[model samples]
Target: MFQLGKTIVSEDILEKEFVCNLSACKGACCVDGDAGAPLTKEETKILEQIFPKVKPFLRPEGIAAIEAQGTWRVGTDQDLETPLIDEKDCAYVIFDGSTALCGIEQAYNQGVLDWKKPVSCHLYPIRVKDFTEFAAVNYDRWDICDDACSLGKELQVPVYQFVKEALIRRFGEDWFSELETVAAQYQKSPRRR
Candidate 1:
């Protein structure tokens, strides 16, 4: 298991060997809270190209804010005062009885749209905490229950490879090296309770 601050997670849970029964949860992650996630420059450009309507919502300044403050708010009700979407919670969510799917995911899969998604969408459950030693990546179990959710079930080798590529495309090679160091440290650390 991995530990980040107060959160604990099992590595086995992250491996693709498991399958997430999100159908049972009815896409609870998407509908209940804000669709909070970070958008890289590439993602923002792609989003602007595809979803012009959402272009105004992409905050370049907010990215700097998140880098400085470690978090930022995305999406709000019509009043625009309350947070409606975040990294762990997405408000424009829909569950078709079983298998939680986001409209963005569906659109990308259907070829109706094309854009680089935010990092949060790419790295669900796992969050990256910037650090001088190494950026800490850990699972956000509190976002959902402890039930084993298989991220690998929906992922194929090509998709996984693409995600890795996207990471490089978004954060550059240096960030990946830093992530490797963090992963190595976690592997060497004592097991979490």
Candidate 2:
């Protein structure tokens, strides 16, 4: 791990490759997880505010879950997260044919809402753990995303490059710029493969 500003970033994000192959996975990351998408406290408020606009984009079961459980819930770990539908799928998840998708993001795409989905959702494969002084940023490897890894390998897209916008969103432009510098230097090392 290397320190960048207030974050301790794992080298795996630079070394490992991943690009979502939605056709292969059919958006399993949104539906197959035991828990709902992780959210910040502020995102919970945004969901509450935008529910009226986002509601129309969601599936019936998702609407029902959100109505019954609220837009967000405290997880077993006490972290804020989106609500779940029947403890199986995220309450904000909608389906296009067989593929699951985020209703919140759908709403964004439709220009119905200004906010995109939660930053955590936007930054998949990179989980951030916030501490008092800094955040720990690390690549999250999941068996379900095997196809994505394969695609990334084929495309030569590193995790950091693939999630460029998200990392910039989570951190700042300057931070990401510094990260790029580190990446360039790291790439020059004979140790890199």
Candidate 3:
């Protein structure tokens, strides 16, 4: 692990390759998880505010779930999270045939809401755990993402590069630039392998 600002970043994020192969996985990461998407405290508030605007883009079941459970719920870990429908998929999950997509994201794409989906969902494979002193940023390896790993390897993209925008969104531009510099130096060393 290495420190970036106050966050301790895992080496797996730099060593491993992962790019979502949506065609193969069909957004299973949204639907197949044991719990709903993780949300920041601020995102919970955003969800409550944007629900009315994002409701139109969601399925009837999703809307019902949201209405019944509220916009977000306290997760098993005592963290805020999106509510699940029938304890199966996330309440905000909308389908394009068999493909699961975020209703909040759909609304954002259509210019209905300013905020996209939760940063936790956006920064898949990189789970960030916040502490009073520093945050732990680590890779979450899952069997569901095997296809993505293969695709990423074929495309020659590292996890950090693939999730550049999300990293910048979570951290700041300056922090990301520092990370890029670190990546460059890490690449030059024989320890990269």
Candidate 4:
């Protein structure tokens, strides 16, 4: 791992590749996970504020789940997370045919809401663990994302490059710039495999 600002980033982000192939996986990440999407304290408030606007875009079951459980819940680990539907799919999930998608994002895409889904959803395949002094940024490998990994390898897109916008959103532009510089130097070094 290498330090960038307050984040300690894993080299796997630069070494591995990933690009979501929604068609292949059918958005399994949203539906198959045991827990709901992670949410920040601010995000829980945003969900509560935007629920009225985002409601129409969601599935009835999702709406029911959210209504029953609230927009977000505290997990056993005490971390904030979106509510789940029947302990399966996320409460904000909507279906585009058989494929699951984020209703919050759809609302934002349609201009019904300003916030585009939770940052955790936007930063898939890169989980951030925040501590008092810094955050650990690492690549998240899942069987559901195998197709994405293959597609990313085929497209020659590194994990860091693929999640550039999310990384910039999580960190700042300057932090991302420094990461790019580090990536450049790492690429030239024999340490790269």
Which portions of model 3 miss their true places by more than 4 Å?
none
What residue runs in model 4 are displaced by over 4 Å at the alpha carbon?
Answer: none
Model 3 lDDT, residue 100, Cα:
87
Residue-by-residue lDDT tens digits, candidate 3, 33-71: 778898899999999999999989988998899899999
Model 4 TM-score (2 dp): 0.98
Candidate lDDT values, in order: 0.45, 0.93, 0.91, 0.92
Model 2 off-target regions past 4 Å? none
RMSD of 2: 0.7
Residue 4 in model 3: shift from native, Å? 1.1
Question: Residue-wise lDDT of candidate 4 within 56-99, one digit each (tens)?
Answer: 99889999999999999997788999999999999998899999
Best-to-worst TM-score order: 2, 4, 3, 1
Error of 4 at 80 (Å): 0.4
TM-score of each: 0.48, 0.98, 0.98, 0.98
Across 132-176, the per-residue lDDT of candidate 1 in tens digits comes to 554554555543533433444444221223245555654677755
- What range of 10 consecutive residues in model 3 has the weakest lDDT sum? 184-193
Alpha-carbon shift of residue 71 in model 1 (angstroms): 17
lDDT of 1 at 56: 28
